[model samples]
Target chain A: MNPKDTSTGTLSYEQAGVNYDLIDPLKVAAQRAAAATGANLAAHGFTEVPASRGESAYVVDVGPFYLASIVECLGTKTLVADDMQKLTGKSYYDSIAQDTIAMAVNDLITVGATPLVVQAYWSAGGSDWFGDAQRSQALVAGWKRACDTCGVAWGGGETPALAGIVEAGRIDLAASCTGLVNPKERLSVGDKLAAGDAIVLLASSGIHANGLSLARKLVERLPQGYLTKLPDGTTYGEALLAPTVLYSPVTEALYKAGITPHYCANITGHGWRKLLRHPATLTYRIDKVPPVTPVLRFMQEHAKQDDREAYSTLNMGAGFALFVRAQDAQRTVEVAQAAGVAALVAGRVEAGPKQLLIEPLGIRFGDDDLQLR
Target chain B: MNPKDTSTGTLSYEQAGVNYDLIDPLKVAAQRAAAATGANLAAHGFTEVPASRGESAYVVDVGPFYLASIVECLGTKTLVADDMQKLTGKSYYDSIAQDTIAMAVNDLITVGATPLVVQAYWSAGGSDWFGDAQRSQALVAGWKRACDTCGVAWGGGETPALAGIVEAGRIDLAASCTGLVNPKERLSVGDKLAAGDAIVLLASSGIHANGLSLARKLVERLPQGYLTKLPDGTTYGEALLAPTVLYSPVTEALYKAGITPHYCANITGHGWRKLLRHPATLTYRIDKVPPVTPVLRFMQEHAKQDDREAYSTLNMGAGFALFVRAQDAQRTVEVAQAAGVAALVAGRVEAGPKQLLIEPLGIRFGDDDLQLR
Candidate 1:
């Protein structure tokens, strides 16, 4: 496998003056506050699947089926599209649509559910933002492609023309997805995750829809702006705009293959440190760190972010991770590879504290770094 | 019942710089382009329920069950929160949160699907905006109340600090909800909607969540800004921010009471004209239009809008409408009243060209006004 295809990822780096430390606590408080109302579901013949509340998506226990729903945003990634369209007269809306859907479906697959319907919420600062038919068509086309890749249907969505709330000329993109886990046996919420599980890493295409606020901030320091060239001669913006890898294929492949992973994690905002997302107290020891690609390397260099920050913030190649029994580890890798995603047995779950250790990089993230609970 | 609670309203009047003529075409193009992709739903063992698209929500046919999903936005409404915080020492985040969730869940109920999970997407132009703990807690509390009122779990959400993409110091709030329609019997898509069906109009509490852009534009003309008093002597912003009625309870009551409506509409954006949202060829006729109340009266009088514009642009008095068989008309009103929401049989359906006629007001909306299809 290509070393650049080996993957690890996180979302904590500060960029554009947005502080994760400040914003995260508000989310934590909101989650805790919402817990009281979770009981309201019981009145309507539904039950809360305990502990699924804080995960990337919330899982609901219906009588005959389990439903998983997630609401996610592409952040400021589409601002890159807005800028690039002005700079190159090229509409990247299609890929921007794909990026938004990828952000939703990718996180959903981690829970072992197959997405059934995907909805789009595209709010432009001005109504004229959609005046460009090329941009509109590209966006709709790209969104459809992403849904097709994920094997889900494009449900419906809202396109609000918010005049004063959004910034002029720029559009904010977000989406929500609903997936079903039938027979209840396919549900994986880390309860089955145990020490000694094999950790398989899946490769990211490149900075899949997180840390754009940081990346946008870093671009201002570049002499060429988005036109700066990387080692491969591709423009900085083009490289950054690479469509996010659809992790759904790998998850679907494994589910069909009957290889049950104890847990899965999408290495987005938190980078490689996300490998330790399991609730069980175990150490994620990484024996091999994926080689950093030029797009990520350029961003790290321009931003003066070190190995720890880059690997923990930019995917550094690893996009998603799966934890499975030792017996199923190789087959899981085979399934991902068969589905055209890079896969490797990068580490093992060890009986220890909840920490993520990158031995080759000589860096570690303590349990305190991940406080989603 | 109080005159203010006599019920039935719509938001159709034209408002500040937002032209549905220009915006609706883009939506039509996008929806048309997206229709090609909806066929992909069959890949996941699910099929798109025919003609469910272009309505308030999308309904998917899952063998033994039908799932309805909706993505709705609280357009520029949160800006009201941002302004109110500056005017008053108090934060209205709780009610803002309730309003956001109500927008999504209310639309879902129109299709007879009980909300199972609701996920929120809050995008701030900057991260520091959430630094206000009071604002965050208020938002969390209000969201919980809305969920509790509607009887659904606060599933999960994505809070993105999108610097430069949204207006600084403001947040763009939207949400998507997934609902379940089981036994396949409770579904109300207007298929059974016969001409002569009684039109039950449900009363809106106040401004609800629509037409804020126009209201905000009119507010600039006020010397007192948010503190400007209406005839009732309440501040303009406070009255406008009245909690939107959580319509889920009414839909749930009608479902449990064995009262099935042929169609339902959440009176927002397009106002009462949304009553014609059903694909069937039918006209909705209004005999007793609900009386306009204080908050709406204040805005219309101040904006110099006429009855046609007021009823069309804002909910005036009617908030939601239900199309039921003539025999079930009174029973539907009883069901809504029992659920704590004021409702009345305000009108009836007839065999004619698609249109909405308010005889008491001598105003009619032709089919050309609404172009969702």
Candidate 2:
């Protein structure tokens, strides 16, 4: 095992930047506010309201089918793209759009729904050079092209010209998508699972829009031009800018195959180990972990980042993880491969205390194992 | 006419302090990046995508109904809320949640769909004094309350603790809602709208979410303590923080009564006249426009705004407008009143060159007529 893969006992978001103290009070305030609204729901006319807080997405059973929608936006990624000077590249818009879709679709899929329509709201600083009619058209065109490919209808959106809040040359982009699911097939983390299931790994396309803030911090500390070069000759920016892998294909295949996995989690900004939010007496033995991609290696080498940190903070290589019956592993892999995705038997479920243990490496990674340092 | 409201000039985003030029380029870049991910939709095995851009929300057709979702966030609203030093107010979250719902549901209802579910996403700033645990809970509560009141379901959501992207105390809130629209009952803006239709008015809470950049600027320039008093003694901040009126009840009533309105428009941040976006000969005579709310009046007086400007920039007490057959005018008002809302027979729709002419006042207001001086 590489030493870099081990815990570094160093601080992260707390040290690099960001103030958790302030966040604590704000969170409390948010909860209070949300509670007040919840009390007012009946008067306001929202029926079938969820009972929990912080769950930003919801579904309503409308007769035989269900309606679901999700809202998300490209965070500081706008700033990163600006800093990297990649805003003009056609791929820039493409990546953000994908992120927007993934953010919404991933949530919808969690509840066993398929996306149908998507809407976006965009705000940008106003300048004659910035609001060029052609650029606006091109941006919208890219969104349409992406939505077209996703089998989702494109709903109308808002493009507000904000003058004060956003700095000049900066734009904020967010999207909302609606989907449909069978009420009987609604999937949630509460679904039952047993030991002895096989874990399947799906390859990821770089960072996929989640932990860019951390990545940017790490990159900023590196020596000049570190990201622009690599042993493979690909610019770090180019490598890191790889679009996120959309899991809809594999998910659909599984659905069609009549296989409902015990758990399916997308590896995003938080990584594979954090997928299970609850304690269960099951251990995961990951023996066939996919090899780390070049982007991960580059960040590790240049930023002196430890492997565990990298894996926890970014997708590394794998984009998604699915736990299913051991007997179904081969079929799952085959189905995924048939859909043009590389699926591997990365691990297995084992009987044990509710914990995530990485075999061979002798490491235990789970919610308990994660720390800012 | 108030001098402040009628002074027509170009209202560029820059004058409000947001730099749209810088933001536009960033928007272009983000869109380009998002496009790459779209191709994966096909690779992932989805079907029937649209070819229009700026559509961030999508819909899926189920046997008898269509499911649609929208994703959007309160752009710059977070900044404004933080600026007002009212981060903990229930009104803050309530208004934003209302706006999020309104943003998506308005569009859905415009096409004659019934909103069923609302999914929200909240990204808490790292330094927020309130931690996400409480904040997330509160947000869910708020969403649930909103959805329940509207007879919409509360779906789950995502609460991402974005360390680097969001500043502490500056939380971003967004929601996407899935709605059901009977195939046989679809509504479009191109429907048969003719002269002599009555334009019914539904009241608004306040400015709602749009034009914040400008409003903030004007407020910033006001003398200290300008918002300190009102005839009723409520603080200006409290008045501005009022939540938007939910139109679901009134809309649902109209739909149930089998009254196919010639046209329905949400009189949002853009005000009454911009509702005519189609290419038809139409004229609007707003003879009894609702009295401007105290909040709006105060803003106008403090900013030295003219009548036309105020009418164009703010909802000014009317949040929704409906163009109905002349015969249905009285029924529309009764329906609205039955729903516990105030309504007014504000205007009449007449045949003209796709223009909105405000008669009696002899002021014509339309998209082209809007100018920022």
Whose TM-score is greatest here? 1
For residues B1-373, write the lDDT of model 2, one tens digit per residue.
1235323443433455555444455465545544434443343244322321223234334556544445544556555555555433333554566666666566556545666666556655544434434434544455656666677654544445544344445555666666655553554343556788888988777766666655565554445432566566765666765666778778888877777676677665456555564456577778887777787777767656577776766777888787788889989988988987789888887766556665655667764753211
Q: Tens digit of lDDT per residue, candidate 1, span B18-42?
A: 6666567667766776677777777
Off by over 4 Å in 1: A1-12, B1-15
What is the number of backbone collisions in each predicted candidate, taken in the order shown? Answer: 22, 120
Docking class of 2: acceptable
- What is the C-alpha lDDT profile of model 1 across A1-373, one tens digit per residue? 1222211222225524567777888888778866776788888778888768666778888778788899889888888888888899999888889899988998887777888788889998887878778898888888888888887877778888887789888899998898887657888888888888899988888877887866776675677999888899999899889988988888888988998788889888777767767677889988976667678877777767678887777788888889999899999989999999988998888999889899998989988776666
State every prediction's TM-score relative to the real structure: 0.94, 0.81
**Per-model DockQ:** 0.69, 0.29
Q: Fnat per model, in the order given?
A: 0.83, 0.30
How many Å off is the CA of B372 in candidate 2?
17
Cα-based lDDT for every prediction: 0.81, 0.60
lDDT tens readout by residue for model 2, A34-87: 444443334323333342233323444455655555666666665565555543
